[model samples]
Target: MTSTVAAIFVGFKQLGIADETDQRAIYSRVTGKPRLSLMKPPEKDAVLAELRRLGFTTVPRRANGRQQLTGRAAKKVQALWIAGWNLGVFDSRDDAALIAFVKRQTGLDHASWLHQAGDTIAVVEALKAWITREAGVDWSPTGKRDAAYLGRYGYKIAWAQWRILHPGADRIARKGFDTFVVATTGTTGMWTEISDAEWQKVMNALGPQVRAARKAKP
Candidate 1:
């Protein structure tokens, strides 16, 4: 009955971080706040105290009023938190089963599945790109961004934009993701780079779209 936010975060491993980061980023985007943490319960409590000390709570009341939770007091957010257990609720010791549950729960057909399990919509939109092979207008010489670079959502988002603005998928692959990832191997056109700024922009802009998409799901 007692645990640290860090422990939960460890339990969540990587996917939890992505989900919470996306949620907090989306909240900041809509409200124009500076930034927020995606920390778990105990850590969140400490962070909440820090915010209180910083006097961020004194500003004009937001839609949800509690800036600490980032308007996430909705039943849906709470439900999302609870739904995470579908992956690990019963089998806590089995890490493989836990990870498997995570995949089953997220159901996002990602290239690498690097992110924490997120809202159902976020997962779906991510899958929409990873699972669907499409054509787009030429942006890169290849016509589509590399799957390895975009992870699940990033590749899909970039490709989707190309399909909308451009029409070919080949050009995207050539120009879109050549240097997107950072390469330890240092091969020609093998890695892609994702800058924090670009990710923040994408999270801010595409997040709402993904969230809306999740809301649209069954």
Candidate 2:
């Protein structure tokens, strides 16, 4: 958890090296990251050495790799973790191309990615700008609008259901009576968002078919 270790860890994360194995070989292990690994060990070691000169210790790895750091270092790690999560670094299953694109655009290829206040601010601004420019304004965090017909909370309920049916769509383009219908359609009328009461009616209409299917099941 020393400042040096903190810096080194940040460097590893920036390089998208989240595997515990990779981290140990490069940053935590006495021998340093393996020369054969794809990781750019020289840059990581350089950063680690610089931080050591600044007074962070070269402590032995704890059993957990992370628990070895002092409480202060742990807190720094946690803060960095939250910052990384907000920036979508920990999302392994997310769009790999998008993550790579962001890394390239931000030049977060080193330990100094968020090393300063100004750097952090600039990274956040750049991320927002990239999201806006590439995905369009509808994807902005604040782009959500009230439902034109369903009022405030109703739209949320309906949208949640719609999302369950279509997991890939991230946001509703507009908040309107027709928005639900349009979003739920993949190839025209395959699905539709309905109110709770309306859904009850659907269930009632399908009750006979449901019973028939159950009876027909082998």
Candidate 3:
């Protein structure tokens, strides 16, 4: 396919307008052919025009180098990263690990903050797809409750630490600990009902206790 047509396809994919079936239908509507490879230049141009009419626009390249991600894209990237962390796909909380993962996915060596809009979108889409395929989790701009908990307190890791520190604790002891946490953090409601800010507060209140538990003898 021509470069213009390829770019049009990428734009449609990014806009979430055309999947494989929809793309074939679009091609048939525009050029009387369902196969892109069969299209001549004129047919390709018609398809491109149709795509533009449907809100597909070419993204301009940065003159100096790759431009930083825009505000919306940056937020999406952050949310996906947090989702990955909660899903255990990303084990490290370091920003460097996120940058490395983005680079591997996008084949762009630049830091995530320096990625062009297209590269940023590609990374975000890939991350979303990977998360969905592996964990069956939908990627949202504001992450889910588990993501909030993990982002705030390293939830799984914290719990693992707690278990190691209190390996002999009984069910009643566990319940007592949970009660203490809830009362100390002023956290109410079920896990799903808690907001992200509330999770942060819960983690903040529990962090010191966990630390003190770690420092105490078994």
TM-scores for every candidate against the unseen true structure = 0.25, 0.27, 0.34
Model 1: C-alpha RMSD to truth? Answer: 17.9
RMSD of each: 17.9, 16.1, 12.4
TM-score of model number 1: 0.25
* Residue-level lDDT tens digits of model 3 in 137-208: 433343463444434333333343344345655533464556644664566734445455554454445545
Output the worst ten-in-a-row residue range by lDDT, candidate 3: 152-161
- What TM value does model 3 have? 0.34
* Of candidates 2 and 1, the better by lDDT: 2
Per-model CA lDDT versus the true structure: 0.36, 0.41, 0.56
Provide the lDDT at 99 for model 2. 32
lDDT of 2: 0.41
Candidate 3 residue runs with Cα over 4 Å from true position? 1-75, 109-115, 139-187, 190-193, 199-218
Model 2 lDDT at residue 200 = 33
Residue range 1-218, candidate 1, lDDT tens digits = 22233322333343333576654553355444433344344344444333333332211234554321122222233222222222112322232332344367566322122222244356434323332333221223232644555454434444444333323546435454334322312345433555433433443343344344434548
Q: The CA-based lDDT of model 1 is what?
A: 0.36
